[model samples]
Every structure is written in structure tokens, then in C-alpha cells.
Target chain A: MLPVIEAGTGPFTQPPTINPAVTADWLVAFLQDEMRARRSVAKAVIGLSGGVDSAVTAFLCARALGPENVHAIRMPYKHSSPASLADAQLVTDALGIHQHTVEITGAVDGYLQLEPEADARRRGNVMARVRMVVLFDQSAKYAALPVGTGNKTERLLGYFTWHADDTPPINPIGDLYKSQVWELARYLGVPRELIEKAPSADLEADQTDESDLGITYARADAILSHMLEGYSNEQLAERGFTEHDVRLVRRRLDGTHWKRHLPTTAMLTNTAINEFYLRPVDF
Target chain B: MEPPVNLDHRAAPLRVAIVQSKPRKGRYEENLRELGEVFAQLTAAQPAPDLVILPEAALTGYFLEGAVYELALDARRFAADLARTWHEAAGGATVDIACGFFENAGGTYYNSAVYVEVEHGKHCVRHVHRKMFLPTYGVFDEERFLSRGRRLQTFETRFGTMALLICEDVWHAIMPTIAAVKGARVLIVPSAAPGRGIEEDDELGSIARWREILHATAAEHGVYLLYAGLAGFEGGKGMTGSSRVVGPRGRTIVQAPALGAHIVRATLDMREIDLARATLPLLGDLGAVLPDLLLDEELPLPRGLHASGH
Candidate 1:
């Protein structure tokens, strides 16, 4: 089935999500601010999943602070392969950050339904939220901040669960697209193999971002850039874009627009109807 | 090993006097006069004190002006005179006096204590200890005027192997631990602590309550911990007079009435220390786990003399 987009629908007309390039000196600074802004933040907490995002965020925090300041928690569910766990250990040992492991299979199974289960999306949200809860628990114990891992592409399409990826005090790569993250990772001296690995949510078996999205990251970046630059939908389609793809992208651009803003507040007084605007500092 | 000191095997309760009062600020003469009255009161009692403990900086209140001008002690002469007066009042009776005073020795001023024995209207001052730990935070400015003490002395008296420490001396783990390890049955602490700055939520009601936790240190280390603190306001600051007595088992056996200039006493058994240490052997485990910075031969001084700043 093909998705459709109505005319005059897109996130461009609304308020922007966080743009790290404008507000932050670097990705590390952004992440640090996020972590320390919370009352419960002790220090920086990382989960070295042997994935590029986690590894990159961990390294950035470690550099911004010190190796001692960065604490890592590795949570491996039942189906997590031995290789992934080994890779996680390798990354943590290499980074020299404090690390602890929690095998979560028993907990996960105890909660599983005996009947037919929910879809992958719901299950993924559950896993993400579970991991977040664990991160928060560990963070409280050490007085550390949980570092989140959700890139720009996932954020734009609302691919992440609201409370899961957003659970961290700091998100180092939240502003950069998947491809730009790749570029930054190379610049940051990340191991080439980890960076080259196909981007996966690792929530389900054999799930890859490119395969699920039905488009390459390079193509998605070009389209996003064009959309962000105020290029019309007609212009995007004219620039070697498919009819169904353009409509699908535009529908996504409209449907997830609410993710880009603070929730609505009711106007209560005179000059209060479109009169009260919140200051950034107040929030 | 045979018992080292000759003490009464049959325990006799002795009156313990704690001069829980601060010295008058910058008025050494007035403070000495006030101390004279306290001494007179203690001596006039039906059963006079077997021992009297005075607070750290008892003669000269927490002196701040000395650090600025480099003249800390004008009270040593006054302290000597006061000692003579107290000796005369005691009427040739041997009274073990832990008198805290500002000691000016070899052109260096120190916050010190003197254990004097009053005999025949003359004084025989024997054991002397300067404060080892000099606090440099909050309200305290000990390091500004006074130099750190290099010794932890345990004096043999008519009582027992009575170990002595000044205010901040008891805060460090090793100081009291070493004193206990060296077979001190009684730990005497003379403190000049000001108690006015306690906030509403400050965990303990007063700083004295926090200091009282030293009872646990005494219990764990198997020693009797006694605190004698200043009571009145001095230099516009409220001095804490919550003096206390703890047994070898870390229990508050007796606590003096809070914020008052008074004397209190308790009967202690020296044998209880060995019994407690035998039951709960925490000190042995701590000894094995902790590195002895004082015992490092590569370092400058010998074991007891090495603790300069804590």
C-alpha cells in the first residue's frame, strides 16, 4: 500500500527540534548539558552496545570529562548473541570506562504474554523503555547521567519511543543524520568495522534501518536537506524523486510534526490568547 | 604480660570535672578569672575531682588575630599563673589536671594541653600534646596561628593508661586507632567547638551530636572515649558544651547537660576494653586492610611522631 500526503503539510511550518549545530559548541557539550541538567544526574553513564552510536557517545563523554567520569552498563537480553556481548565488552575495555553487565532474559520472559503478542514496534518500545529504566537505576546508584543514542533521522521520523531515547540527560548524536554520524565517527577515530556495520535497532532479529525504511541514508539525507531548506515537494520529486516516495516522505514529515514542539498550554488571561510565550530559560 | 600500671583493682567512682566553657575572646585575663571560679567550684565539692579535663584553646579562645599579625600566644604566662592558683586551691592534694592552654615554645605558638599534678602548692606538669589535626574549614582557622602536633601521647596516671587527644585529633581514624592499639583504656578529648551555625536540616541537632559518633570509634577500637567541650559564647560565637562519656562498647554511658558550664563524671572499668575487642574484632580487620602511612619507614618520622597534618 502506498502512503499519501495532502497539500500544505510538513514540519517546516512548525517549531524546530533541537539543532545542536546552532546551540552547542560540540556534540559532547550538548550531551554533557543534557546529562547534568537533570537533578538526579551524578556523572555520565554509557551503554557500550558495540554499536556506533553508543561507542561514539561514550568516547565523546569520556573525552569531554575523563575516563573516570564515564560509567557503562551493558544490558543483554536472552536472544542477544554472544558475539554482540563480546563486541560490547571489547568497546568498554578499549574505552577504559567503568562497565557492568545485566542479563535481562529472565525479567523479559517473566513479562512475556502466553498468547499472541503485540507487533515489533510495541515490543521495541518496551525493550527501549526497559533499557532506559535500567540506565536510570544505575545512574541513581552512581549519581551518573544516562547518555541517549538516537540520531537525527530516527528523531525526524519519530522512529524512537518518546520516553526511551529521550530518557538520557544528553544525546550526543541526536542532531546529526545517520550518514553525518558516520563521518563524525570516522573523524573521532572509531573502529572502522563498527561504523561500517549496517545500522540496526537491535530490538528484533535481522532488522536494519535501510531495509525497513526502503531507502538509503544518503538518499534520505538529500531529501531531508531539501525539505529543511524550504524546497517544495514538486522540486524534491523533480530532483529524481519517485511519486510514491515523495508522498510517503511528505506524509511522515506532516504526521511526526508534533514531535518537534512542547505540548500545548491553554491561554487563560487577557493578552494570553497567543499572548504568553515561554522563555527558553524558564523551561 | 603482667599489668603495667598499679591501679585500684576494686573500682572506686571518681568525680570527673569537664570545664565545658569557652574562653573570653581576646580577654585572656577575664577568661582565666572565670576559669578560677570553675576550678574553685570543682575543688569545693564534697568529693573533689580525681581528674579535670579542659577544652582545646581553653586559655585563649579560637584566636584569629594572631594568624593576621603572627602573635598568637599572650596567655602562656597567664596559664602558668592559673595553674599555680589551681594548685594552691587543691591544697597539696594530687589532682590529675588536663589543662588546655596556648603554649609558646621556642617562638612557636601551639594549641596544647598539659597534664599537671598539683602537689604542695607547686605544679608538676608532665604529659604534653599539641593538637594533631588542625581544621581549616567552616568556622575553624586552627592552621592560621597554631602548628600541628607531632605526637599522640598516652600517659600512665592513677586512673589507667589514659590516652589524650585535642579537638580535631579524634577525627582522623588512625590517631585514636593507634592510641587504642598501643593499649590505651581511656581516650580523653578536650575540644573548643563553637555550636551556633547549625541549620534546621543539619543531620544531627548540633555538631556535638556528630562528634558523639566517635563513641562508635571508641567501641570498635575498644577504648573509653570522653569529650570535654566549651559551653558559653565567645567572640560572638556559641561554643558547644555537649560533653559526653562513652563506654568501651560505643554506648553513651553519660552525657553532660547541653550548652552549660558544668562538671560530670562516670565510673569506667579498664578490663571492658579487652572484653569488647575480643568479641568484635573490627580493629584487627581494619589493621589488615588499611595501609599504615605512619608506619612507612621511607617516610620522615617514627610511627607516632609522623602524624603532622590530618
Candidate 2:
């Protein structure tokens, strides 16, 4: 069951809600159709992070492509919490999907050794990219398509590592906000422990996503949704949102526009890939 | 093209099959094969449908952008191909198909729908309705790629006088009114509406909005409205597939599921148009005042004219 957030209560109170059942059915069909739109890819390879986003994605994939065809790759670093790995295992076991554990501490440290002066942000980026490397390799090894786990909130706020978590060719939940992902996760019967846990990239010790982003997913999602609807900052403040949180979300959203799109290409002709010579991904 | 058999005074019901199809993007032959399978299933039914309707861009998936030029087929060739497929599946069975496709007319490309009558191994192009309104806002960019159609007219079918309105055409109020005024007893709307807005309960906001349009148009014109919607995904955008048939009384006769490929069947009694119109008399009233309304439109307004003056 999902919480019913009433409208006109407060700024963080009216995050967009979804019909989880309809969303799940639509996404399952989407996964099946898009996975085989261009080719005959029947299997999906997902990086299981034990978080609501990835867990919800895994459940959808298991339903779209049969559990036997879904490959859940759990790549954990040395400093990653043991609880995260356990939760991921619980999801795989419940779904009866194939699971692979690849410890990324060695691979991440192999590149970070030369950058001893790198900060936590840089180190986390390296770990995220390394996990992606393992994920893509496993996808190739298993002959399965890599499915992205990034949600719309992270994509809009630029919370994800560019070219790492957002590199997959297709994403089932990319359009869903993080708050919506939680609602879907609950609807999909994800483990209660995982759903109740604080969301984290698990790149470092005690680093929750809210603390790093300076705003909760619930609050940020509401602000982002309203802003996308053309709500002004003053209007948002009038609607009971704190000025500080609104500024933080807007700044992150505006500054990371590049992360949401492909790399800039210098246009020299009448037709350019994606810019002028446009074709839908399925096309 | 052979002329349709006159059935203006016929009181028999028209059996309609609305195929909520999911066309593989850029794969015309594959979609044709799949449609053949659907035709075969329909042929096996005890009471075969007189007409089968497919969603907008049923042969080539929606959201084609520049690829519309590549996938578009001339009306004659498209009708012939459909005739061949129908002949292979149903043999001597005769069925009318109203399907949306990218059309190549001379050198211009248009988002068009064709109403073709297929029998045995032959096909006739009853009418071709190029989409008048090419939506260009939000996720849509049809106007940028395909040329807009210029005419809005109804034609004779085996069932009676009918009109075809593509997805966005029905969104405008005047389109359906004009079709009704032009003596369309039934309105066929083939759509490729993308699922959007999750705020509504148990239904997508877009689908709910479409239902409003369908019900209002059907009730207002006292005409049977058949809407066939495209199902499946194109670049993550899911086309909502709640294809439906609305009777003249504004009640849904039958509807497909919200997603995936499914066919919905409905038997429409053409006499219901007369019955409903006799009860409401709205279309009759509109027709009576239409000439006066047009004369009013032709005359220029006086200076400083206002509603108070009127």
C-alpha cells in the first residue's frame, strides 16, 4: 500500500502520485517491446543495488523477461555496507533470477591508486564507473541487454554519475521519479527492509543520498515536479516550500542539463546525428 | 475502385473489430504478417466483422520523425498489399479495413489513413483521409515532418456515410461537428496517443481525456464513434491502447485493455443514430441553423461590436 499524499498541504506534501498497477503493466510491456524492437534480445542484465530504484527495476525486468532470463549483478566495493549486499541477495532469491557477485574494491582501487589526492566525490565516481564496467562486461558475457536503473529524480537533479549509471541503452524506470520509484517498489512487493532503508549510493561510509543532496527525495521530487509544471520559485514558496530547498533543487537541475543529454556535437552539415538526422531510438 | 453497395436504408447492424495493434517500428513486412494472423483469427469467428479498424500508423509505428519518408507507401500500393494479405488469410471473405499509414502522395509525405474494401484477391480504395491536424507540441513533432491534410469530408461505405479522423483531429471540437453536419453517421478515429500524466486514478490522464472527447463527440453528433488506439512502446513512450466504441447515447459499448495488443468487438446499429437524434435533436437543430450561421460568419462585424450590442 502507498501513502496518500493530499494536495495543498505543504510543498513536500504533493509529490506526483501514480497508478502503480497500471504503471507496472505499462512498464513490463515497454521492456518487452523495446528490448526486442530492433533486435531479438530476450534477456536483461541489471545491476542490483538493493535500493528501491534498482529493486523495482529488477522486479519489472523479472516480470517482463522471465526470471530465468534476468541476470542480477551485485557489484559491491570493500567499504560498501554488508546489509546492502544482503538486501540485493534477498531480491534475487525472491525473484529466482540469476545472481553474480563481483567485488569492485580491487578494480576501483587499481585506478584510484594513482589519484591518491582524489576527494570522496572523485573516488565515488571511479567506483560507479567501475561498477558499470563490470555490469557491461557481465552483460556481454551473458548475451543480455544492460538495463539502466536510474530514476527520473536522479536524472533531473543530476545525482547520478554521468556515463556510468545512465549509460544503458534502455531504462524501464528512467521516467519515474525517485519518490514514484518507492511507490512502485512497494506495489511490486519489494523487501520491506530495503524499502524502509535510507537511500545511498553506498560509495562511502554513512553517506545517505539526502545528506549529499541537501534535500530529501520527497521534497526534491515535489519541487522538481512543480517546477516542470512552470511553477515559479515565489509560487513554490507561497505553496509552503522552503526557499533553501527550492534553490538547491533548481540549481542542481539547471546546472546538470548536460548530464541529461548526449555530448555536444559540432554541426557542420544539414543533417547531424540526433540534432538534424533525427530518428527515434526504436526506429 | 469498385463503388460501395448502397446500404443507406439498411437497418442491419455493422460488426466492427477494433485491433489495438503494436506495429514494430520501421518493420512493415513484420507488421503485415502479424496483421494477417489477426485477420485469420477474425475469419475463424462465427460472425466475422464487416470492418476492422487499426490505430494510427499501424503499418509503421508512430514517432518515425525523418523515417516517415522511408516507410511511407503510395495509396495504391498500400491498398494492394493489404488486399494481398487479407486474401491470403480470409480467402473469399470480404472485409473493410481502415488503417493509418505514412502516405507518399506525389513527392509529399502525409500522415494518412486509408479505408480500403478487400474481397477475395481484390481491394478498392474507398477513401483516404490525410491527418488534418499534425500535433507539434510536447513529445509530438508531426507537423515538422509530415504535411498537413487539407480536406475534411465523409464518404459512402458499405455500412453508410462515415468519416475518418486521425488522433489529433478529434481533439478539436469543430472537426467532429463538421463531419456530422456533412452526413457522417459513424466516425472512425485511429489514434497513437502516448500515455501521459499519472495524476488520474486507475487511468492515464491522456486516456481519460480521450474518453471525454469520444463520448462528447458521439453523444453530440448522435453517431457511433469507433476509436482504435496503437499499443506498445516507441523510445520509452508507451502508446496507451484503450481502444473503444462509443454508442450514440455516449455509452462505451466495448473497450480494450490499457496496454498491449488486444482486439475489441462491437456491433453498432446504425438506426441508433436516428433514435438518439430524435430524442436529443441537437444535430437537427444545428443543421437547421447552419446556413444562417455561415451567413453570419460571411458578414463583417460593425465597428466597436460587442456582446452587449448583440
**Model 2, range B53-148, lDDT digits (tens) per residue?**
999999789999998889999999898888888899899898999999999999899999999998877788999999999999999999899999
List the per-model TM-score of the A chain.
0.80, 0.94
- At residue A8, candidate 1 shows an lDDT of 22
Q: In CAPRI terms, where does candidate 2 land? A: incorrect
Stretches of candidate 2 exceeding 4 Å from the true structure: A1-283, B297-310
DockQ of 1: 0.01
CA lDDT scores, all candidates in order: 0.68, 0.88
Predicted candidate 2 versus true structure: per-residue lDDT over A1-283, tens digit per residue = 1111111233234787899999999999999888866658989999999888889999999999899999999999899999999999999988999999999989989888989999999999999999899999999999999999999999999998999999998999998988899899999999998999999989889989999899999889899987875566876786688999889999999999999988999999888788789987666
Angstrom error at residue B244, model 1? 1.3
Which residue pairs of candidate 2 clash? Answer: none
lDDT of 1: 0.68
Residue-by-residue lDDT tens digits, candidate 1, A1-283: 1111111224322223334334334765655555555443547877667678777787788776677888888888776656667766766777788989977666556566642377767767767777888888988888777778777877876667777776675577787777677776666667777788887777778877788777677667667755764555775665466666667666777788777554666777765534565355415
Worst 10 residues of 1 chain B by lDDT: B67-76
TM-score of chain A of 2: 0.94
**For model 1, how does the per-residue alpha-carbon lDDT over B172-254 read when each residue is reduced to its tens digit?**
87788888766677888888776653554743356745455677678788777878776677656777666777767787666
